[model samples]
Target: MLNTNNVDCCARVRHGPSVAGLQQALGNGAMSNSISDIENSKCLLVLATTAPTPIPSSPAG
Candidate 1:
């Protein structure tokens, strides 16, 4: 059976572990003691490595 009128016919999936990890990473300071300690610390240092991508656009017809 199929329905042609449904724009949302495609299925979407979310990975459980990945979602949990993301939630932990972005969670508030109350979620962990370490985060709260860091928040209360007088001096803080942050290091990060990022890979950036160029802007994308449709090609000329």
Candidate 2:
């Protein structure tokens, strides 16, 4: 359920109250053009600068 509200909060927290991050994220190719575009998209790809796993995490735990 990612939306503007969540993105705003995340951007503010992560980037320190800068809307630039939010705008960049919204304009990113990974982001959907519109709600309809998101609904129609079947495949999702996420690439992060940070790793996906946490310290005590497991592949099959």
Best by lDDT: 2
Candidate 2 lDDT (Cα, 0 to 1):
0.50
lDDT of 2 at 41: 86
* lDDT of each candidate versus the true structure: 0.49, 0.50
In model 1, the Cα lDDT at residue 33 comes to: 48
Compose the digit string of candidate 1's lDDT tens values, residues 1-61: 2866544311123234655665788763223447779879999675552327332233224
Per residue, candidate 2 scores C-alpha lDDT tens digits across 1-61 of: 3654532233324454335655676754233367887679898676664656443322233
User: Which pairs clash (backbone N, Cα, C closer than 3 Å) in model 2?
Assistant: none
* Backbone clashes, each candidate: 0, 0
How far in Å is the alpha carbon of 23 misplaced in model 1? 0.2
What's the residue-level lDDT of 2 in candidate 1? 82
Model 2 regions more than 4 Å off: 1-8, 16-32, 49-61
Residue 35, model 2: Cα distance from true site in angstroms: 2.2
Estimate TM-scores for all models. 0.25, 0.32
Name the lDDT of candidate 1.
Answer: 0.49
Worst 10 residues of 2 by lDDT: 6-15
